[model samples]
Structure formats: structure tokens, C-alpha cells
Target: MALTVSIVQLAISVIAFPIFLLHFLGLWDRTCKKLFPYFMEQVTKSYNREMSAKKQELFSNLQDFAGSSGKVTLMEIGCGTGANFKFYPPGCRITCVDPNPNFEKFLIKSIAENQHLQFERFIVAPGEDMPQIADNSMDVVVCTLVLCSVEQQEKFIKEMYRVLRPGGAFYFMEHVAAEPSSWNFFWQQALKPTWQLMFDGCDLTRETWKALERGSFSKLNLQHLQAPLSWKIIRPHIVGYATK
Candidate 1:
């Protein structure tokens, strides 16, 4: 049994080794883009379930401002597969930005299923550079589980600030770095190189909360929570909002 298990693990590693090598060469973005939807369904679903309450609260904040205007204008960065669409209220005019164009079809399908949201536009761009979105044009800026993978997190936050109208809220839910003494922290450091390569540049040890604070939103409210053990390496999470 041990020998069989070893062989199976070896075979799987061998198959995946070339992919990781290519990913490190900066040539894997396309492949990562294509695999994103599958990763959401297979990996993120369980994490979503474990953090459903926090997710609900993060989205629930929109309730206070929903439909206050003719339509609630929302912009989402790294809007992968539109997983957060169901949380938004009906008649929300949404602008989605993602570096990967492959997510367009998946996002469209999600929008169709949600029925509450209106698909405004899909821009094939990263969060760090969004010159097309006018200043103070958005009512809400939504980002969840995305900061972990962005190339320039600070620039991304600044862009969100620039695009949101005065009093608009930025909602976020992200897995952050574990505590220094924890087992997960050790493993996170140990596996970071491979993990980032395999998971589209996601960092397991990012201090995302600090970045949010640095954005200097007018109002900041945040809370930390321990993620379910199934996701230990990236277990610590911060969920809340910052208003500009």
C-alpha cells in the first residue's frame, strides 16, 4: 500500500512539474487563466462554504445602499467566474474587470443565473491599471479573494479609491497570512514558491489588512477570523469595508 501510494504521488508530481516550471518562466498566465474556473469550483467552493457567514456580512453591507439611486453601480476587480454576483441586489449595474478574458463566459453565465444584477461591461484589464473607469464613477467597489494574486496590491487599492464616488464603500474578503508561530505559517513560507506558480501568483503570506488600512479610506471597519483547517496555509482572513 505504501509503495503504491508513493508511485501515485510521484506520477502526479511528474505530470505537474512541467506546468510549474512553465509558470515560473512567466509563460503560465494563459494556462492559469484557463484553469481558474475549474479551481473555483473544485477548491474555492469549500472555502466559500466555510466562510459563508462572513461572506454574507461582507455582501450584506450593500443592503443599506441598494437601490438608493436609480441603480446601484458596482465595479469588481478580478471578478473571477462572478462567484459574488448572487450576493448583490437586483438592478445592480456592474462593471467587471479581470486580467483573464477567459472568465467572460463564466461571468456571463453567473450574471444570467443571478438575475438580480445587470451586466454593464467586462473589461479585459488588471486592477492595477484602470484608466478607462472615470474618477468617482462607482457606487461600490467589490473585491473578494483577489488581492492575494494581484501583481501590485497597493496600486490596485489606489485605483479602487480613485474610481469610487465619495461615500462609496469598498467591500473585501481575503485570506491573509497566518500567525508567525503557527504550523500553517511555516508551511506557507515553505510552499510559497510552488503555490504561487500553481495558483496564478497567489501569496499565502500577504498582510492584506495592512494594505487596506494604508488606502486611508475615510471609514475603516475590519475583523479577523480563522479560516477552516481545510485551508490552513491560507487560513487567516480579514473581511470588512473601507469607505472613501
Candidate 2:
């Protein structure tokens, strides 16, 4: 019986080993592109419903801006699967920026549903570098749950600053690091490597709020809160807007 069980385990390992190697060798990018959006679609639906009140209040500011202006121009960094499309105000034109090109199809579908907002363009580039977008041309810049994965929050914030017109607003919602010495923080640190690998480069312990503060926006109105109970590790969050 022991030998039979050992052989079964060995066969399983042999079958799984090559797939793991392929994932490490960059073949996983294709699989991730196909699978992550489907996973995100379900996750975003829960987030939107669970955090409805907060999302509404935060997006109200942008709605006001769009209503006041004849044609408000908005740019969204890391606009994954266009999950925030339903929250945008009417008549606002949006520029979507995302490194994952696979998100384009999902974004188009979302855009079609939210016909109130105009889809100006989609740029396949990281938020840290978007020279194609003219400086001081955007009325609002939106970011949600993106800073945790960005290579440099400072650079990303600087890019937002550069692109926003005078008095433009940056709307952000992000999950950040838990308090030090806490059990959540310890788990975040211990599981960071595996978490990031599984979640497309997301860092569970990023001090994203600090990076936003370092940007010195003309007016910052950020507040700290805990994420939903479902998200145990990456629970600490900051959500609000800043004016450039």
C-alpha cells in the first residue's frame, strides 16, 4: 500500500513539474492574460456591490466635475477590464491605459454598456511612462487598486501630476500595507512572494498612501480604511481624491 501511494505521488509530481517550469519561463503570461480577466470580473462585481457607498461618494466628485465642464477629459491608469466604467459620469471622455493588452476586449464590452462616457483611446503602456498623452490635458485621472502592482508609485503619481491640467483631480482607491506588528502584516510579509507570483505582481505590503502623500498634490483628501473581510492580507486601504 505504501509503495502504491508513493508511485501515485511521483506520477502527479512528474505531470506537474513541466507546467511549473513553463510558468516560470514566461509562458504563464498568456495563461494569466486569459484567466485573470475572468477572475477579476467576478471579483470586481463583489467589490462594486460591497463597496457601493464608498465608490459612490468618491466618484461623486468626478461626476460634479464632469457636470460642470462641457467636456471633461479623464484618464485611467491600470484600467483593468474597465471595472470602473459604470461609475463614471455622463459626457466625460476617457483615456484608458493598461499594460495588459488582453484587457482591451473586456474594456470595449464595458464601454459599450456605459455609453454615457466616451471612449477616446486605449494606450497599451505602463502608468510610469505615457508620453503619448499630452501634459496638462487631462481634467481627471482615475486609479483603483493599481498602485500595489506598479513598479514605482512615485513615478506613477508624478506621471498623473504631469498629465493633469491645473486644478485637475486625481481619484484613487488602493489597498495598502497593514499596520506593523500586526498579525495581518506578518502574514503579508511571509506570503508576499507567492502572493505576488499568483496575482500578477501585486505587492501586499506596499505603502502606497505614503507615495501619494509624497507627491504633494495641491489638495489631498485621503482617508484610511480596512478592506472587506474577504481580503484578509491586503486589507488596509486609502480612498479619495487629490487636486493637481
Candidate 3:
């Protein structure tokens, strides 16, 4: 029996090795990007409904960044699938940025569907380092459901501040880590490794506020609330704006 079990384990490892290597090389992410937008659409259906009210209130604070054009100049980092496009105020000129070029087509389609907002351009760049966007240039910066997956939390948060002009607003909504003593926190830590690997490196236990607090925003108005996500680990969310 022991010999048979050992042989079976070896066979399973041999079969899984190639797939593991492919994932390590990010071929899996490249392949999955084709379907991820569609998948996200399905997944956020109910989630979007629950959060719509809060989003409306958050976006209502849009300021006219375009002096005479009467348009808000906005930049969205990690603008996946243009999920927040509908929430933007009318006549806003939006520059969308994401590390993945695969998102461009999906964003184009999303922009087509939501004609209220103006599409400026889509740049393929990560949030932590976007040199094409000059320092203190953007009027408003938005990020939603993206903080958990960034490569460096502190660097990315600071980057958001750098690109925003003085007196600009940085709007953010993100699922965050649970309270330290809670049962959810235990599970968040336990499942994090596998979750990070499978979910494109989303860390369930990120204390996102720490980095945000360090960002040196002139005025930060952060609020913590439980979102209506079925996944308990991702239910704790923080949403608000920071003025630079």
C-alpha cells in the first residue's frame, strides 16, 4: 500500500510540474487575460449592485479639473474592464492606465457602452512607475479593487500621490484585511498563499490603510466598512478620498 501511494504521488507531481512552470512564467496570466474581463463581469454583477449607492456618493465629489472645458480630468490606475466608468460624472476626460495591455480592448468596449465619460487614452503601465504621467499633473486619481494585487503596497500608494497635482483628489475603494483577532483573519492568513497564486497575486491580509496613511496626502478621509462580498476574507473594505 505504501509503495502504491508513493508511486501515485510521484506520477501526480510529474504531471503537475509543467503546468506549475507555465504559471510561474505568467503564461497562465496571459492566457487567462482573454477571459478575465468576462469572468469579472459575471463575478461583480451582484457586488456592483450592492456597492452602487456608495460609488455614486463617492463620485459625486468630482471637480472640474479642465479649467474652461467644464470637464473633470481624471486618471484611473489599474482600470480593469473600466468597471468604474459608469460611476464617473458626465463630460469627464479620463486617462486609463493598467499594467496589462490585454485590458485595452475590454476598456474600449466598456467606454463605448458608457458614453457619459470621455476617453482620453489608455496607457500600458503599472501604478508604481508611470513616467509618462508627469508629477503633479492629474487632477483626480481613482483606484478600485486593485490595491490588494499591487507588487509593492507602499510604493504604489506613494506613486498615486506623486502623480496628483496639489489640491487634487485621490479616490479609492479597496477590499482589505480583517481585524487581527477575528476568525476571518486566521483564514485570511491560512488561505493567502494559494489565494495569491490563483487570484493573480491578490493578498487577502493586506493592511492597506498603513500604506495609504504613509502616502502623505494633505487630507485623507478614509472609512472602513464591510462590503457585501460572499467571500468573507474579501468583505472588509475601505473606501474614501484623499486630497493632495
Candidate 4:
């Protein structure tokens, strides 16, 4: 199985080289608009939903903010397809943000299905900087499976802290790199080139928890665990909440 995974990754690297070149020429994003979103939905939506549901405690800090605003005000960064909607408490007002404009139609579709929550608006912005959202306003912030793809981890975490209220909580779940000396780390590094090209800037070995600890969060609770996936290439996971 290990040999097979390595061979498959090598083949992918060979195939992705041309796409990587296309990316530099600015033709890749334009060409893969529909293909990327649909493929992402198919690949991650179900797995994300199931993992978030099982580790429901990540959102446990939300109750403290229930009556803070007539309802809990939540901002979800990189909220692709609105996949985490079902896991939120009832009546929460959610504001969605993502860098891709192509996801609006699909996000609207998901919002339509989830009648239990109220959506504030959808903003086309990356997680690193969201000046549109006022500072210290949101009661809670949520981001799942998105840190790996961001351009810079520290800037994104800092932005989350900036938008959060004095007592606001930021919930995060991400798949990270395995141990450096382990066999999986070898594959992660080997696959880095093609993997990032195939999936928009997503690194297989991002130690995001370190950046979170460096942020200005007043309190943080982080846990390391494995995601419920059959493959080890993307299974190392972390879930936690940081209070500002």
C-alpha cells in the first residue's frame, strides 16, 4: 500500500507540472472554475460534515454568546459550500467569506437547504485580510479545513482575532503534517509540489497550531487527532477554539 501511494503521488506530480505552468499564466483558475468547486464539494463536503459532527465540542464555547446579541453572531472564513451549517446551533446569524466568487451559487443553494440559520451576507475575500468586517464585532468565528490553503497562516489568525469581540471565540479544524521522522512525512514532502498545484495552494504539511499559539488569543484549547479518513496523506488533524 505504501508503495502504491508513493507511485500514485509520483504520477500525480508528473501530470500536475503542466497545470502548474498554466497557473503561472493565469489560465488555470479561469479554466477550472466549475471543475474546482464541484470537485472540492465531492471530495471534502461529506468528510468535513461528518468530522465536525463527531467533534461537536469545538463549538461548545458558543453558548456563552447566545444572548450577547439577540442571537450568536458568527463569521465563517473560507466557508465553501456552507458545509458546516448543520453543526451550528439554531438561529445563529452567519456571515460567509471566501476568496472564490464561483462558490456563491452553490453557497446560496446550501443556505436555502439550511433554514434553521440566518445568513448575513457573502463576501468575496481571502482569510488573510478582511477589512470589510469591522474589528471586535463578531461573537464567534469558524474556519474548517481551510488553513492549509491560505497564503500566510499568521496573518489569517491575526485577522480572526481582530474581528472577534472581547470575549469572542474562534473555532478551527485543520489537517496538518505528520511527524518529521515518520514515513508519512516523507510522502507529504514528496507530494508537496503537485499537491499544492492540484489543490489551490494547499500544503500537505502545514503546522498551523504553532501560528495559532503565537496569536493574541487570551485562551486556547487545541487537540491533535486523526481524521476519519482511509488514507494517511491527509489524515493528521487538529480541532480547537481560541478565545480573544
lDDT of each: 0.82, 0.83, 0.82, 0.85
Using TM-score as the yardstick, the better of models 2 and 3 is: 2
Best candidate, TM-score: 4
Clashes of each: 0, 0, 1, 0
Error of 2 at 211 (Å): 0.6
Residue lDDT tens for model 3, 1-244? 4454456545654656665577789787776666666766766666678888988888877754443566788999999888898888888889999987877888898999999988999999989998899898788999998999998988887888898888889999999899988877766776665566556778888888888898888889999999867777788999999988
lDDT of candidate 1 over 124-208, digit per residue (tens): 9999999989999999999888999987889999998999988889999888888877766766666666677788889988989
Predicted model with the maximum lDDT:
4
TM-score of each: 0.88, 0.88, 0.87, 0.90
Tell me which residue pairs clash in candidate 4: none
Model 4 misplaced regions, further than 4 Å:
1-12, 49-52
Give candidate 1's whole-model lDDT.
0.82
List candidate 2 segments past 4 Å from native.
1-20, 67-69
Candidate 4 to native Cα RMSD, angstroms? 3.1
Residue-by-residue lDDT tens digits, candidate 2, 160-185: 89999888899999988898878777
Model 4 clashing-pair count: 0
